[model samples]
Target chain A: MAVDMTQKPILVVKDLNVHYDTGKGPAKAVNDVSFSLRPGERLGLIGESGSGKTTMATALMRLTRAPGRIVSGSVELDGQDLLKLSDKDLREVRLRDIALMPQGAMSSLNPVMRLEEQMIDAIVAHVPNLKRPELDARVQQLLKQVGLEPEVARRYPHELSGGMKQRAAMAIATSLSPKVIVADEPTSALDVVVQRQVMQTLGRLQDGLGAAVVLIGHDMGLIAQFADTVGVMYAGKIVEIGPVRQMIEAPKHPYTKLLVESLPGIEVKQALVGIPGLPPPLVNLPTGCSFNPRCPFAFDRCRSETPQLQEVVPSQFAACHLYPDHKELPPLPARATRELHA
Target chain B: MSKEIVRYIATRFGQLLVVVFVAVSVNFIIPRLLPGDPVQTALARLQTSGGAANVDIQAVSAAYRARYGLDAPVWQQYINYWGDLLTLDLGVSFANFPEKVSTMIGNALPWSVTLLAVATLIAFSVGSLLGARLAWPTAGRGIKSLVPFLMVLTSIPFYLLAIILIYFFAVVLKWFPPAGGVDTTRIMRLDWATTYDILEHAFLPCMAIVLGNVGFWALGMRSQMVNVLGEDYITFAEAKGLHPRRIFVWYGMRNALLAQVTALALSLGSVVSGAVLVEVIFNYPGLGSLLYVAIRGQDYFVIQGVVLMLIVSLAVLLFIVDLLYPLLDPRIRR
Candidate 1:
């Protein structure tokens, strides 16, 4: 894929692959995934469940446990290779360079402890040099930044509504002002209204920090709303990636085309062609393209020949046989076309 | 705040009173309902010894019935029993030998409470910490490998572990004495030296109880921690670039530990009231062992009174624990 010629990337992941060694065999959840984020840029990773979206997010944090290992990869944040860093060095990088906003983590806050205590504990952990009064002021400021009532800091997690909890989570996520923040499905579980509010909060926080964000979600509409770039994943590989507008307008990969069409808000009049069949089991995936079985364009060559992501246009990239010849393909099927009202 | 606490305490205490009354009455009535008079059994032993024994069985039975008010109608007996209980006059023990029922309890109470309370606290606190440590995925492979084995060990009964400890520490190694509290000779003087001696003697038994429960507590806490660690707040703390230890210890541990504390408190109360096997194995003069022997000897009044005391104590313990819930969990408070 053609790289942006001008920008210096703040975060770069190359050949990132994660696999779980289950009792049966190894399941390749993420395979040869590569992406880069420039300073202050927002990249959205969109995929269905088991599409390696979560795996990629956690692999960034080294959060996956033993059976699930990052087989081969280099996660470079601000030019430092995170994969090669020592545990202590990684800890430093995690706190000061890159942070993660974990999904559905708000309910886990200590009910017996006040929010101020929990938030202060976070500050103390990474930035121990702060004075007590400064710490208290920072916590109060954080609560305010997250749009919470100032007194919310003194309340327990359970006392807050779900949206408030997500805000609190975002506040903490941005607390250290790390260069890159990886948020995995931050708004997936929230109500529609709360979801919009939380997303806006995240946007505002990201804007304030000017930190690169890797927003992981399956919702294309959500990605369209916030993400500057969209990376469409299928069976553990980036099937398509480009500017969000370009990808939504002229998705080159069949997988991306289907995802954009499946979005509920998109003004498609015909019956939405739901992606037939579930995502392939990471273990014992089909030969050649993992999406081949469900790919309408699949043929003899598509079955046996593996497709690598290659440049399709000036900046767009896709992994598909139809785009193999580097020629502009026909418009997507009627059902895959974008609706004006979307 | 104080009003909520008072209401919480009052409701709990009132519930405890009802439970205690029910338990004590059940202890009194169930035995009476059984065929064959307890007094007859006592007299039967005397009769076997021949007329030279000179024990009047009928008079003895009448006195026994009168003492417990069993000579009255059953309903009247119950009402009178409650009347005596309200006045804190639980009647004289039919088998106290020389002391009053209340006096025996006074002497034994301290020993039981000290042993059980210390042992439970040690087991719960240490076990919970260890469990939390092992729950961390990054802690290492060695500890992770032990989780399954610990879970298997958790299934073993507490008494089985106690017996194993007794066999190794008491009978085999002989590092600690097999049973009883302190040297009987040293128990009379409650001096520092003797107190230390008493604690030393109780150590093996206390440790035995702790070992029996530590695995279970660890397993329980580990599971709770595993779930809590996945909570969004913990993730938020981590995202905030919170130190791993702070996220885990303060946020993760504190939240997950509420369940552990509740379980521990309930277990401790039950353990205090029902230390039967441990007391029997160690020959500690706890309430369980005392009541066990009293029933076997058919010491009717002593057994009844001790059972009532145990029931009441257990009820009170539960009440206190219930009251502590709102204090521990702010969400439970208004």
Candidate 2:
């Protein structure tokens, strides 16, 4: 798991903010958040629904549409500020420099086109000079690299299985060997066995291209296995982030601790532990730490003050008031723990 | 074409045959269903028009009955009707005897078909493109301004539009002729001069059809394009870094066109019916005008021929649409 310290990060996101303009008010989907990834690094971001995991992934690629605007921040890819790039420049950087493996693999491919044509669409958009035969060969190679047969090149998306379609999309995402791949729940629509295989393919593709990946998903177990570093997102913020082993075993933030324990256990035969309350509404979040109402350890300071992410332990960062005062996250009170409905 | 497509086409062709059979049967039965005898009606009209008030009225009526094969049983006439239809013999027009119904319709068919073909092609293409652009987030102000204008055009009937076009382009402006299909004084020839003259007269009627219909197509296509633009594939296409124009046509319009094609199929009947009014207003040398003249003269045979031709053409159009759908959407190939 040791990455070379001398290797400068391939991607850096600094204080990024994205807001969705609603009739009620601007919903702060992605609050000030920052993370960096070295070449060949994989960062898994896990959160509950509407936790800004997807918004942050899309904003990093500068693909945020109207109603959802990248308020202010810089997504620097190899020291180039992507936000300030012209439309032409941004298009050039996309697919060639960074690619997005979309979440809805079931519907992501254009239904009218053949599998080969969709791949060619991505390849030729970036490398327009390739000859027809060369493009055909390239598509075949990309598809085969993802464990699909060469004959799959002629099939339409509707003709392929869900797993095969997902792998085909993966083939297109990694066609140009981009510097960064933002995979937003690429396996969300697939079953477990297929999910594992797809993730492995994604990892192998990353290894081959030496690209950094920001894997966004809800399955903590899957992310923990595939990603070297894991970050926990809460109400538009990353509450805690550390190496995968420590983030799961010795989380520094109370939210991360509850999240890890909440994972259902098979051997114990105990009722599932549930986080008591729902996520806060984005438009009208509480005054202090967004999780205060749900945080069992909430105190006066935790209520009145919003904590910024700080390194409480080596290489571990957390946004919690208990940090720097208490060396470790305090144990959860037994009385406050509640069992989820079976 | 693949085997699946070929099979699909065969199925659609069968449907077309059924529709044609039903339409032809109805056309035959309609003439027979009239309250009065068609022979008496024709004779009465002829006498009024001074076609022979003195030439032995009873003998003339009996001769007419024998010429029309009305002397035979009803079943025999039905059998002869089918036999004649097989040979493309639609019988002679009562208003212009000895000029066969088939021959008359043949001359007029091209005009109506040409007008419909040219107008629909132009209107569908231009309106679809404009509508697709209007649905795009980056569509300019110039295209947006056409919305109100297109809506108004769609609301106006085609015949009304024909009158207005005649007034402005034919009467006031004198840029083109007001009525008819071509110059009356010139000898019809297959040359540029004749082509230009014919175009000059056909221009107003064509515009009436095109203008009245373009708005329906544009609005239909715009709404479809809007829905398609919101699909995940569109967003994925943008994420793939495709040029906006490429995405607009290949991804956006290409998908939206499936619905537009369906809409076009549903609207063809109305388009043909609407063109009837436009053709009459312009006095154009098309089947519509011929049908109008035949109806006034109670020329049952010509009316039957024209109606049959129109219904058959509509069936063919529907068949083409049915065969085309699976090509655009593979999911329907099954």
Candidate 3:
């Protein structure tokens, strides 16, 4: 399942802003988020809980249901604006163009129904025109693709262990060979061993389908291992974006620097430095920068004026006022370097 | 495979035995503890006018007690009772001239099973389905608005409703018979039309039983459905791009039904016992009516024996249900 990374960009997003009408007022859950994913590109969207990383991924496929509306966003999948499509049109795009491996795979399956019936149900929903024999063959191939025994098709969800259920879930998610796969915390609830297997299977699926992968989680270590492009989100905004190496070695934003420093190192025992202050509640967000209350480098200007995401280096962007002086800021000090190498 | 089946059968039969033993002991012991000789009371009333009157109280009571073996020591009576229960040898009914308690059960058993089982199945299935619908978010505000009214209907008593239905349909409108099973005129020459006629007369009673049980099942199933609707797997099913209907029916209802089926199984026992009021209301010649007559006549053997039989049947049904729990919920198999 070795994919050619040289293929054209398959999914692109520009100035995506999503807001939820919570009756108290409209809270901006995702604001001015933008990124492009090339075919077979493994992009990791890493942030702490409530950072709107998942909201961004869900908005891609128009999976946002009720209250959480896509207020202002342009989600382009191969030049198709998903926002403008009708309900019927969105269904066609969901499984064929983009698929989702949602959070909580263990409890996500039907308990009474056999695993194969669930998979077959997914196939009929998207490709209703496929004959029964073709559908059967496709489902079997998918189970094998995810490294499951074909005999598991007859077993119910409760019969399988947590890891097996997750693998089976992934099998159904990718049954249609969707072009873009958004895996939202797919391995969060699994053990470390099973997590590796699930993630590895996800990587292989991305390669096999040549899909643009959006891996959403709070684990920076996992993103560092698999992602090609890393988007560091803070309080519903993508605060930093760049090639994985540049973001890891030469982080510009204070929050991204803290996130990278917080990763557990292999060598020396460096005290992990976590970002201070909680993310602003979506109901009544901070006036200027949402991260300003937590940003240690918050000057008078930072407190009063929100920072627009601007280019700080070649093909690298950061939403912080500290990068205003230097167009291409150098990497942080090696004490921070010990954060990754320790 | 045979070993598993054998183990299951033995376990079920063992549970049935325990339940039967406990129920019979309670039936026998509770009456004795309630004060006064039941045999003496029966004979005292029989020896004179229906009213409690003074007569040769000692001699008549002694003759009655000795005749029925009630003059034996309490421990010996208890042993005989247990032995008769074990042998399915229910003694003569004190109320009937020569009828055995077991004969009464053999006559009335079919009537009870048919009336109660059919009514309960109808109520549970329809009520659960309706509850599932009410729980659906897409059912809209107008349909959702009816849930409270339906719940109110469920709270009304079945006996009160049965009497009201009898007054209107039987007395006022004269659409059907007021009471009793099938037409007695055609009882000996039973056929399809006679069977259908019996069911027609039994409909109001069945409706009463169903009315009492439907509310609980609907409310329980609806609440469970609401909880299951929000689970991650249901959302995952939607994310897999499955149709809204398939996700609701296959993923939503199927999982929700696993929980509902266990509740339904337990309710079967309750329906059998609870059908007493409905049976009495209709005079359907079931065990309820027979028990009513036996109670009025102070027939100790018949009352105790019938109570024991009902308990044993309920125990057997419950045992089968417990064994079936793993079939509905695969998680329980482990």
Candidate 4:
């Protein structure tokens, strides 16, 4: 899981803030989020639904529509500030530098178009004047890379099976060999076995293209298997980020700990415990820590002051008062001791 | 073509045939059920117009009925009617004696078809383009201003619009002729002068139909375009960095037009019948006016022929639409 730090990052996002004007008020969807992706690095973004994972991804692409706007952010791809690019320039950056493998394979493709047509559209948009035969050859090769037969190019989106569609989508996303690919739950709609196949295809494609990828999903196991590093998001901010092994084995943040503990195990007979309460409404979040209302470790300071994401271990950061930097805060009793006392 | 498409076409064709048959049969039965004998009514009109009190009305009615083959038994007459229909012989008009029903429809069909074709085409193209612009995310003030105007135009009935147009352009300003499809003084020909006169006279009725219909097309296209724009594919297209124009045309309009195609097909099929109100208001020599005259004069044969023609055209139009649908939408191909 070791990544070389000397390599320049392919994509760098800093202080990203996305707000949605829902008429009632502005809801903070993404708040001061910062991340950097090294070349060929796979960064998994894990969060429950409504955690703004998709919104953050969309904002990075500058594809956020009306009622939802990027309030402030700097998305830098290869030293180019994407937020400052013109509409035309942004469009060029989209397919030529950073591509998106959107969620819902069944619906992501234009149903009326043949697979070849859709793929060629993406390819030719950036590299215009590509001759028909050359485009056709490229499409066939891309499809083959995704393990699809060449004849699948003629089939419409509706004709392809769920796995086939996802693969075709992957082909389209990687056809131009962009430096970065942001996939938003690409395998969420597929079955488990198909999910594995898709993930492997994505992994293989990313390796072949050497593209840094932002893999957004809620499945911790999939992220652990696929991503080199994991960023656990909660209510618009990344509460914990570290190497996948460390995040899974010894999560520092209470939310990440709960997420890991929530995964059902087949080897042992353990009762599954759901997160106790719903996420706070973004328009009116609780004061101090956003998670304080639901946090079992909440104390006087935890309820009074918001904690910042600070490094608790080498290369592992968590935003929690339990860390040593917040020495004034009292730590809760250990879980084992509390259970024994109960 | 694939075997599945062939099977789909076959099934649709069979359904169309059944629909046409039912419609034709209903066309025949409905006219027969109307009270009063057509020949008797025709003879009474003739007598009243001539002011001949000494005429034997019953004898004249019997002779006229016998001539028109109405003296036969009901079942026999129905069989003969179907036989004539199958042979493409529409029989004679009772209202206009000795003139065949086919000849009357033949003379009127062109005017109705031409008027509707021109109007609907203009309406569809302009309305759809405007609708698409209005629904576009980047649509500006100019396009937005047309919404209220289009709403008002569409709210007015065809006849009311026609009457207003006639009052302004024909009566008040004398900018165009008030009535008729063409200048009767000039013999019907394909020369420029004749064509100009026809178009000049057609202007108001055409405007009426277009103004009344364009609003619906624009509104329908706008709503459909809005829905299509929200689809996942549109977002995906944007992600691909497609040109705004290409995305609007191929991704947005292509899907939106699917729903509008049915409306277009139905309107095209009914073109032969013409907009009765527009035709009547302008006194244009179209099928609508012919139908009005035929009904008032109690011409059963002409009524049956016109209704049957409309039904057959509608079924054919629907069949064509069904065949072309899979080409536009791949989901239906399966």
Supply DockQ values for each candidate: 0.54, 0.76, 0.56, 0.79
Highest TM-score: give the candidate number: 2
| Candidate 3 lDDT over residue span B218-295, tens digit each | 888788898998888877776777777777777777777877888877676667766877788888888888887777
lDDT of each: 0.78, 0.89, 0.80, 0.85
Q: lDDT score, residue B103, model 3?
A: 88
- Candidate topping DockQ: 4
For residues B1-334, could you state the per-residue lDDT of candidate 4 as single tens digits? 8899999999999999899878877876775787877666666775776633455667656655664488777788878777877777887766565578889888998998788878988998889988988999999998899999999988887788888999999999999999999987989888999989999999889988888888889998999999999898898899999999999999999989888887787666444444776898788998888888777766667877877776786688778888889888887876
Instruction: State TM-scores per candidate.
Output: 0.88, 0.96, 0.88, 0.93
Residue B25 in candidate 1 has what lDDT?
78
Over A144-260, each residue of candidate 4 has an lDDT whose tens digit, in order, gives: 999999999998887899999999989988988999999999999999999999999999888888889999999999999999999999999889998889898888888888788
The CAPRI class of candidate 1 is: medium
Interface RMSD of each: 2.6, 0.8, 1.7, 0.8
Quality of candidate 4 docking, DockQ: 0.79
Candidate 3 scores an fnat of: 0.77
Query: What lDDT would candidate 4 get against the real structure?
Result: 0.85
